[model samples]
Target: MKLKHYIITSLVLAVNLSALAQSGLQKKADNLFNKFAFVNAANVYKELISKNDNADYATRQLADCYAFMRNPDEAVIYYKTVVQQANVPTEYYYKYAQALRGIKDYKESRVWLKRFKDAGGDINDSKFLKDADFINTIFNAKPQYTLKDVKFNSKYSDFAAYEKDGNVYFASSRDEGVLKTHNYGWNNEPFLDIYVKAETDTVVSTKSKIKGDINTVFHEGPLTISKDGKTLYFSRNNFNKQVLGKSNEGITNLKIYKATLIDNKWKNIEEVSFNSDDYSVSHPALSNDDSKLYFTSDMSGGLGGTDIYYVDIKNDGSYGTPQNLGNVINTNKNESFPFINNEGSFFFASDGHPGLGLLDIFGTVSDNNKIVSVINFGIPVNSSKDDFSFFMSEDGLSGYFASNRDGGVGSDDIYAYDRTPQLKIEGTITDAKTNKPIANATVTLLDSNNNQIATLQTDNNGHYEINIDRDTDYYVNTKKEDFLDKIIPVTSKGVEKSVTSINANISINPNTNKVTPITELQPIYFDFNKYDIRRDSTVELDQIVSLMKTTYPNMVIKIESHTDARGTVDYNNELSEERAKATYDYLINKGINPARITSYKGFGEQKLTNQCNGTVPCTEEQHQLNRRTQFIVIRMQ
Candidate 1:
């Protein structure tokens, strides 16, 4: 009986020791996670789960580690396990949905997103829930930038490329001997340090660590320099004056520091006043005028995991209170790395908005300094992996960004990109005499040098569309059997929008002997609220005068003018009348006798060519189509 009691007691003692061992392991893993050492934390959590000790907690931590590392494939594996369990946090459902999106499993992502909302997640903060076609929209968007790999990327993580003067400054985890002792626990890589590629250097080996007292034994980099190169702002671990600051939880946070340039070397390092030891503040950027400083932070009262913030830089060099960028530029997920180009366009990184995958870069549409909407910097600028840290030049034509996508030299590499606006020419082909749609008409596009760029046959509806290069002049030639060829000149210059649409309708004359007299000409357009003839409008109006006075000497025509669906209907009617009279006067002054003119009237917004009848939203191009004058022949001899 005593032997049986002894065996039971020994078994209980064994169980207690095993439980204690697991508790210790959990603490160690949690500590590493708090320090952003996700790789090491994941391994420890995996070991704990292997023993089936504290399995639920270990599994959740393992999922979180992968999620933070931007490894959505692995994250989904473990998140799937934890989310199915009873009493799981509501946030897990949202995280799983995001991971599913990262893998392009959008159907399943929506299902989980709905579940997340049903389980008490805030639907207002969910972008996917608001737009049902968000994924398709992103996939179908025309790429706006051409990306190319830089020659200096290393096998280790390298990113945040900033150009100043003739040098390219960036942050890298590449090994610098002796400083190798400062290896980071996060990815088992050497701590990131500021490095520069001199303008005179032609090879990657010529790049070297920056000369300054800025770098430390801890992580330091991802910096921004002033326009004059006299000041610098950079991110670093919470270490200063040989002292490392830690939060109450013993986690080290990042802080933004300022340095002055003295005799070509960075000196006089000082922390920004807004920094706190409790939360991180990093990724500094300056406005074009240097009147404001932008940064990323998680200090307090933010709407997301991290958010973009800004502070006004007074003329005396003092900073105003830091202000959150608000809901338009932030989300419940992370938003970081704020940059402003010379044109005042705001750019940043976000995983919260709809994107191709993890941490895609986004831009803002600001109206008088207030962000009204956001736009994703679609594929090539974004990939199915982490992409962030976008920086553009003063011209807003070319720039750099960082990505950890496939076919790269390292985990994170800087890529150069040139911005290209999407330009297109589309219209219909019709017979000049009958005004009937002509099907299967051959349309050939030629560049300024008369070289054929593309050729295609119009569809059954007589509609043809083709892409064209930006800021180039092109000629569109339309031809068909028994029809005279028509060549129209189109130029894409001084186009300010990202998408330029040119409508080039072509009317071909029939080659048969029984031909109808030419009566129709290109519509004449007017500037907003103006009735005076423009230089371009004279081209179309002269065609009208020629047809009436010369081509068909007895041609009788009626002029009709219309206005876009804006302002009061009465005002539009009055404006259209003035436009119609302007067209009538121009033809008469150009030697067309008044006897050939039958009538002139304004249609206002009644005869719209498209579906932009005021209630429906329309682009500027669509509105421009309605503000025009057209001439119809009542009788042509």
Candidate 2:
């Protein structure tokens, strides 16, 4: 047929014309997508399809709409169509492969990946793997250290590990070379001491060293080894350069110390006093790849009774502040023996809350870092006594931790059990500004996509902890009423990869308590019959401004006025609107941001507390009940 005579040319042109004509629809589609209205965007794309069947690009856009909305189920279909298009570039094949994987269709996804690669697609797409849509908690990785009762007679507790070359070093209270004696824990001798075992095949041999020269007469345990095995760091109670020293109270205190490993043996033992004194600073765990050290100390400047602390070892080998592990981990109840595994696992013991007894071992895995999965090692692993001081190795398998089980030899005996199935993450929570712990704060745990896992309030000491699973990304957010929320991101880069106490420091300014004292933030009241200004309003506003000036000086104030149901709806609406505007203008004149004022909505008579009909004249007291002015806090500086 001749081009001019045939109607097909016009028909095809008409489709293209319609495709271009859908400009208005395109804007709406973009707007919907911007607002995360992906489902609706897909519907709009569908309309465009009905209008112009030849719109291959629009068809593909529909699928992309679903992908952006994370609706993989629907996105897969559209992506396939996009690939089938004759004009689709090879790069588009890469996008298609990812969409198929997004829907959990690994089989189909692989097929597309092959097609993409065969079509000259870069292999980088494979590098970016999306976290699975679901989680399954399976105890993976072989145990590095099992529960071990090192105590010859009685067991106190043990934690912290030192891996130096071929030797596996750790803290224990079972027996030492010198008398095999230790503080009875209560008052007698403590049996705690640093023990060394030969690591034949990534497993600590039973022939680990006991009663080494480093284990003096008093107590010696909880050690950290440098990468070169040249430096041996540990904590001890009853400090002295020699066997034992004297202190005032029966302070079961601990101080950090280190010695040089000479000729495959520890020598020139020294006490770590960079930030410790006559107090307790035990449970020292060194980072696998970094000089940053982690330990538990009862130092006077800590946030609470017993807390975990960290110090930065600069390139020059100097120490920084003994930063408290913060409220995210430490609590009023003794939180001792913190051990982190490189396989995304954090182990510690707490007698504070939710445990079998004295000190129960717990594991915490952060999902999106907002909700913390707090799981007790369950039964058998935890007894009614102090069962803490746990450690784990890189393989995610058998590790060591001391427990005082019933079958042990004495009051406290060392016992070894399999590490539980769990995941671990470490980070800090501190005031954003001061980089200090937001004491007594609340930390919430969330899963990969920000779903809440669990929440724990930081003790007045400012630290939190919970056991979690290895399945999903865990995010944590630390929040206080008037402070900005903080998030601890849960990346699977290995929890123990970089060893610093998960010291998440959240910056929180002290909540401004304006001299205006209303006691509670409930609905505010205003004087009746007048909209000018009340004395009480000034008092409240003063406090409001006080807080505003300090925390959010530049924030805009949205003043909303309300009235009781004594008048017509229209009248009340107008009156409240005027009152609200008046307040807004006043704040503006006083140097607050007018641009920050996001306009006040007047609910007016709609939300009246009473239903007094016009026929009945309600008392003034009844009418005064609903008169109020409410201010919304937008954002703080």
Tens digit of lDDT per residue, candidate 1, span 1-637? 0000000000000000000112456668765654335577788899988977457767877886676555679988998998887556566777788778777898998888789889877644445543322322222223444666588888877888888887888887886567676677766777777888987876655237777788887878678888888999999989999999999989898899999999888999999999899998888999988888998888779996888899998888889999999998899988888887776667788889877677877766544466766666455567778888888767655678888778888777788876554457888899999998899898877777766654667878888766665677888888898798889888877666666577888889996643354536778988877778999999888877776677788778889999998878999999999999999998888888888888999988889899988788999899989999988776665
Q: Encode model 2's per-residue lDDT on 1-637: one tens digit a residue.
A: 0000000000000001111112346546544543234456567779877876325656766765655444567777877888887646454566566677766677887788788789876565534354321110001112212344343323333344434455555554445344644335343544555666665434332245443457655556666667675776766665565545544664445667777867767777666646443566666766665566887766676666677777887897667878886665667867776665563345567666455567766655343332133335534456666676665545443445454555655444444444333333334456656677656567766667675544556655565544444334567777886576667665434555233223334556545642233332334565654566566666766666565666555655566788777667888788787777667666666666567777876667666667653466888777766787787755444
Q: TM-scores, in order shown?
A: 0.51, 0.39
lDDT (Cα atoms) of all candidates against the true structure: 0.74, 0.55
Off by over 4 Å in 2: 1-191, 199-213, 243-252, 366-375, 417-637
For candidate 2, what is the lDDT? 0.55
The local lDDT score (0 to 100) that residue 392 gets in candidate 2 is: 50
The per-residue C-alpha lDDT of model 1 at residue 190 equals: 78
Query: Which is the leading candidate under lDDT?
Result: 1
